[model samples]
Target: MAGEPQPSGAPTKGGWITFPFLIATMAGLAVASGGWVSNIIVYLINEFNIKSVDAAQIANIINGCVSMFPILGAILADSFFGSFTIISASSLISLAGIVLLTLTAVIDSLKPAPCENGSTLCMGPSKTQLGILYTSLALSSIGVAGTRFTLATMGADQFDNPKHQGVFFNWHFFTMYAGTVVSMVGFVYMEDNVGWGLGYGLCVAANLIGLAIFVAGKRYYRLMKPQSSPFTRLAYVIVAALRKRKVLLSSKSEDYWQETQAEGTKFVRTTPTNSFKFLDHAALIIHGDTNSDGSIKKQWNLCTLQQVEDLKTLFRISPLWSTGILLSTPIAIQISLTVLQVLAMDRHLGPTFQIPAGTMMVFVMLSSSISLAIIDRFLLPTFQKLTGTSATPLQLIGVGHALNVLSMAISALVESKRLETARSYNLNGNSIVPLSVFWMVPQLVTVGVGEAFHLPGNVSLYYQEFPKSLKSTAAAMVSMYIGIAFYLGTAIIDFLQKTTRWLPNGINDGRMNNVYWVLTLIALINFGYYLICTWLYEYQNVERKELSKSSPYPC
Candidate 1:
């Protein structure tokens, strides 16, 4: 596998192959870790008594916290621990969580009682089940946060610098989907059919394998130093932007001179313009009458504070991006809530029909994988060529979400019909839907395209907007979006079941029918968010050469 034994002494371009493999290994681990939780939603709902929405909330809290933690993980990875130590530590904690889950599952008395929904019988377990689950989830979150950033950075490491990495950047995402392709099958099977103890035990084993793979390749992998303090600097930018006095611009003809005193030296703002004190750097061209000679004097100062604003300003204001990702709540629900909902409904998927609740995920990810191959191999490039703008990722996302809007619209419609039938009968593995089970396949495929588009969008967008100093921070944006989307989805579903149409006889009321529509509404909101983000996108790219400029660390 190391290819022709490396010829003992000869130098090789192994970096190309080795670096990518290492990254894939890490990405694969991330997928498996996450898949464990994703596949468990059904178990939590059916065997454990956790309700559809609450189960989703539980998954969201765990997954979201892990993602949110990366902000800190980035801090730690950059400053104190470095990628190796932090990633290792995170994996161990997650391992501990898996161990605990297994032990508690075996003990039985330690498990949580299912939520108090009248739809199913309530079973008693240990009062500590909930606590143990929370602890396990939190541990997994920490590991996930740690793993996510390093892998992306490591993937980017395969390229000499960020410049030539553009195509690789696209491949990076494709490989990530590749890992999902595997986990979608492997983890889903373990979580659903195997039950909790062995299911989590396998997760632990997979993480161990993943960790070993990382350790073995430590010599080949690259680790970058943390660029800057996100929180501290963000705070500084906000205070500076708001607290500083505003500067007024003055202009004139003969010898046109404008000045402001700052930090002492009669600082010239630009080579050709009046001084503006507020901007760290400013560029301007001024018209001035030269004695008997006509000349236009231009001044430019690479004003850091004024022109670029401070990176901290990003912290001060983040509404649009946050809300936009929040719209993706259904994504989180799909893995957690929807998986459970699908499992509980007495699927009629027989030899010609039955779709394993967890196993179906492989098809879901397969759709994404095929979509990725098509997009990276064809669709995105083709779209980019036709659009004449470098907005490949956004274009796909916008279109995908539009299709998604329609797909969910169908889900909402189908679910409504299904629910009416659900009222009189409890659906099971052998149960039938009013429409053929095949109808759900399109919904699955729609979710798949959204997966492909959204994942790449998060990766590219963050990498671009984040200045060189904060590329690692930029990497975490995907996790953050996933987190927000998951939580918001849960909130919306909960709101619907508890507050509106589903309230009296709503899906949340221990019934399968109500859960479907709640998910439908969430998809609609997410679609709206997707539309706005696509429209407002000021698509940008990071030149590979800038990678050398941004990082003092070696790739």
Candidate 2:
């Protein structure tokens, strides 16, 4: 298979493909990326002399960029270059960013001088210095987005079997979470105890190594050819549907345009589903819509019924996807706030060992990792056995919502207790509360459990439900939700700061309990909305099964 004819960079269709190379690259990149990102808030505050809340906001913005660009990456992979080219290029970009970040740590001139003790005034980074920092963040964030989700598609491309694909996805997530844990614990500890220079230098090395390993396995990867943009087809369907809005939809399948190779050959045709009947107009054949040979006359003004229905399918699933944004927003808020809480609480495990504030998120990642295994191995199978049917994605999402609401309540309670402890200890200003940081673990674990249920469920649902042509976009939708949520979290924090005194620079002064209460209410409301949407939604693949069983076309 390796000797078979193929393009210069692409491997043959059949061979021992290098999926492990992709996985290893993903793991290394994940570690390097997570190391910097997880501790960015602390770095900005301690080194760059930014305010705590401002640093958190900046971190959220960076996270938003990282999450958002994957859609663009997916589009580029599907329409222009394949995943291999994109990943290679993005990895190089990331390495450059990490190198720049390393410079800020190594060179004292690149950063503002450390604040003097008992000084109220501290100098922030100069505009030029900030520009350099922001540039590095932009490059690294975009680079991470490009490689992370796209690699999932590339790895799955290596396998022909659905079972193999499922296994790959499981391991992909496992490696991702494990890498995150390593960065959050080991790398963050190094940054806190040793030096930022050493920590960031390690990140640069990891990225370079990941890139080198990826490039070395060039001949062992199964590459997919780029196709024409599916977005264009979707646009044509919309334009055609609007142009033919008054055209009556026919019950007979013959009236709709089905694909044919030539005059005498016909393709296996699917009848448009009864849902979204208005979109069916796009497929209704008008006298001037097609050529004599049955090709489209005006590319933008005419489309097949299948094309129109494909657009409708996207429309159907959109509300459900929007629910994920709401689901993630509170989780984002929790992560940032949890870090802030750790900063203000007793993080010491013993007389000597103290946990880094940035590393508190380890609880969430740890809980999520374990929950993933339990959900896959025990919970899902038991549920299926009890019900005599596998739980639908919607049901899994509903479970997640319940757990999130509970988690928010727990967060509120913990904060309330912490606030009481602060008050009791006379810790009014710049003093850590006497409360133990372990109080945050339960809420973090709860949210992690919610993530374990909904993250995979949402990804699986989108991948299964989206049109075959839009599979890359489907995978990217999850990233879109997370990106939007991070931005939304930032906005929510800003809003609270402006409107209320719930989130001051110091956690000791701020009424964080109220913020958690607000999030809990919102999560509950969002859950209700999700439930209504779930009730209203119907699966779109029934027609495909029916079409496969019996042809709509007459002989």
Candidate 3:
């Protein structure tokens, strides 16, 4: 039985057959995560009696935490446990967090009483209550960070062909967006109309179901075992380079350490390129650095040429990564403020139904989901045909920046219009302004379209350009950018609030349009910085492949 193939109809290790299970798990987790996060501002303001601005700030900080922690999760996945184990364990943690969050909604003692209608003063939550709430949020945020990008890497692992991986990535975003749409619209509606407890209870159920489905499909996964930590090697390279800093440089490739076959693997190592020549010293087989079999005699004294180059590659790419942080900060601020904008505007569809403030984010998700398909299927192909080449990732990101700048301008104009309407009505004291919430849609849609370009573009660029040792880390790099952006945006907002009257407790009395204008100026400057970085950068892998295939021209 051990040697035999058993049954003709038995399931295989990995194939298209695993798609349904993977997608179902993704959807369930997305719904669960979105259910809590999409409505957090409203939940805090209404149920916990927090100020609107303060609630948005908390939401941004939480978002930053969720995005940033993924780097640690990815490191753990690539260096120790594989993605499946991390995903399973993190789902359980998230489920526990959701259960606690649901308890806060259900138990009267967990939250302060609701503010009376038309009353400005409300009791703040006690330290004990705030402590429990924050603990629950921290758990869920950590849980989300563990699973988000890790699942994409796992699904990509199932496919050997790069084309198949590309297709899977598209479906990953699609499923994520679809789930977010459901949670933002349906779950948010439940929270606004029925009760927060029921909505959060559904989140708990979704997390449980997602975890179960993932566990059930364990046999079908193509799990990658963790090797020694890549970060450890990167650190070794830096240390070795500094130690050999006084040594003379060499132009010859033969002087550096490269494997005929990489240790413990059969694949031949590629020759080191000429870039970042200073790092070549790390691989120089200087006196007392290596043993008889060419093994390193001292861990901190010698590293392979590939490892040094890997560190250099990260250094070269970092400026580009920093650009994304600046690009995303404005978007983060816009997202947080847009919810508050919705609260102050007319949300009616007709006489019977009104849009929930949280549900408006569904437009961004919907735009991204639909726009992704169009870009992948139609836009990119058309550009490739007309230009006789595929658009590079940098080019795609450039387009995204242009779109984002446009979105910011529109946001400023729309806010100005809303504020003008408020002044005309002399309704500065009223909670609801006369402006339609739908006016906010153009900016959201534009931001979504920009995301459709930049997000996948960054993922593809990192995956293609990063050294083979750091694939999972590459995916998390995108998360790191967004995380820093959120936190930085929080700092900027707090700073502005403390220094100026542009953002007070209420928006109607504040110059929100000026904030948008400031964001627009920052975005434009960041775009210029990105252009310089992209212009100076070379694609290491792509350039080498092109060079190897090129023939010398005859005189």
RMSD of each: 9.2, 4.7, 4.8
lDDT digits (tens) for residues 1-555 of candidate 1 = 122233478555434655545655666575657566556556566556665556666766776776677777767766677666777787777777777666766665667545464434556445567777667667776776676666555555555645545555555555665666566566666555565666667667777777777777766655555444654544443443343335333342222223334675766543332222233213121223122343322222121332233343343225445644644665565555445446435556565445557666565677877886676667645654785444444454566556555555666665566556665565433234344445456777877877666666655556565555455565576667767776675676667666654433124234444444555665567667666655664433345345323321111
| Each prediction's whole-model lDDT (CA) | 0.56, 0.84, 0.85
**CA lDDT, candidate 2, residue 395:** 76
Choose 1 or 3, whichever is better by TM-score: 3
- Give per-residue lDDT, candidate 1, residue 141: 66
TM-score of 1: 0.73
Candidate 3's error at 185, in angstroms? 1.2
Question: Could you tell me which 10 consecutive residues in candidate 1 have the lowest summed lDDT?
Answer: 281-290
Q: Candidate 3 — which pairs collide? A: none
lDDT of residue 336 for candidate 2:
81
* Weakest ten-residue segment in model 2 by summed lDDT: 546-555
Clashes of each: 29, 0, 0
lDDT, model 2, position 12: 57
